[model samples]
Target: MPHSHYAPRQHASARADAPRQHQPARPDAPRQHTSARADAPRQHQPARPDAPRMSSTTSSIPFVSASMDLSQDPSSPYYVHPSDNPASALVSPVLNGENYNHWSIGMKRSLISKQKLALIDGSILMPPKTDPTYKAWERANNMVISWITRSVSPSIAQSIVWMDKTYEIWEELEERLSQGNLYRIAELHQCIFNFRQGELDISNYFTQLKILWDELDNFRPLPKCTCEAMPDTKKYFMEDRVIAFLRGLNDTYAGIRSQIMILEPLPSLRKVFSLVIQQERQTFGNETDMKVMAINGPWRGRGSSVNRGR
Candidate 1:
């Protein structure tokens, strides 16, 4: 109870209960934040593609863009490819006067592939000069004309000198050439009869015959019979062709022909052709072997004589 600065010291419990004074925060200490991230610099973010935009008018409508691809549209026949030009040779063999059948067929195929067959077949009629596609049709038609003119001999080209349209040229050619189907049939028959494999090989002979047969077929189209007899009719025709093919072969194939004919069911023309070809190969090989033996026989004889003397 002595006067110690005239003041008594408070207990430790009262000091602990007293409020503390304010202090500056340390750099590394966790501080109370006013906002979680309100003061931080904002980052630029790209809009999501699927997110709806906040527009009063457009918010209710979907954002869309569309484009049409028409480069490969098949229904558009007026489109001429960039590669199709005046100087392009479509067919291998150009049209000559006598080969109209072959030339016309080739031209038809080439035009059909190019989608320009309608121009020549009278399907795509000409349009008036005032029409929007008139110039387009004219350009395509002129291109076709150039191809046709260049695909024929000079003398033959003269025939189409006055023609202007594709159909005109095509019709003119067909008229001038297709009139002699009967005469052509007779000529083909004569040629087939005269054609023989005397000096020619089997393949060449068959190829020549096929050419004649195909040409004749164009003139004389096969019947499109769906009847029950159609099968028998085709078989009869096949047998006739086999006979014709065998008849053209050299006399060497006579035995093979006999063997083929003796069968109850005659083989197909191609089968008979293959069989004859095999026989031909065998005959050729045997001849080659015999020639080799003949050449070696004399040498062998000489060698034996020389050895005996020695």
Candidate 2:
């Protein structure tokens, strides 16, 4: 019964010659070889012209790769996305000579998102000339330099083209173009002082003022005040801003401004904004009513003069 016609070929004498007729693709089979090549199957082998032989006893183990590149890994510090290029400006606005502050802020934000800020910020120091990593470091440095060059205007790029390191170019730009935030702070103050609701509506005027105030805040953050009197320093500054907002409003809001001032603790900037918007709506409604009444007639005003005026 052992060699009966009904028996499967695997259970027959053919099992003895299975190594030649059918070589199973087992992962552990390499360990059994007395002499293994230096370039074994475990190493990276290019796609061969012949199809791989697979059998029922094939191993599921994956082959080991020879390459150790981390550029594909998102979490790796050395990782660079395939899409990122030097010609692509990560920021929307290009850096001209005058807009250093805005441009620098935009660039810092873009660099931080890419995880390549370390390359320029001195976190990744240059390795030795003899070191293998020095080449990689140099490549990344060039990439950052290219990005900066493309982002700035041609004149600025020409000045920084000869610079070796990323940090030097960045520092040089800051040194050359940045007139210190003090000048910007003063300019902001003057603009804010002069800004008023002349032709602009309440919402538009407030938006303009808010933008200036926000930019100024970025340039000059309030100092840390641990003293007893200055414990709530930001609160006082906020109140001052509220006053500034009111001072810039059109004269039509004099009544509204006076009412807001009489409050002991003073209303917040947000509260004042809402109140002024409401007053603007009411004033607009009154003006509209006056226009409609003037067009209709003086029927209610002088009894029968409505028909005479027509």
How badly does each model clash, as a count of residue pairs? 0, 0
For model 2, residues 94-149, the per-residue Cα lDDT tens digits are 88887888888889888888887887777877779886556666777888889999
Q: Write the per-residue lDDT of candidate 1 for residues 213-251, one digit (tens) a residue.
A: 888888877799899999998998888788889888888
Per-model TM-score, in order, reads 0.66, 0.65
Model 1: lowest-lDDT 10 consecutive positions: 301-310
- Candidate 1: residue 137 Cα off by (Å): 0.9
Sequence-dependent TM-score of model 2: 0.65
lDDT of 2 at 183: 83
Off by over 4 Å in 1: 1-75, 286-310
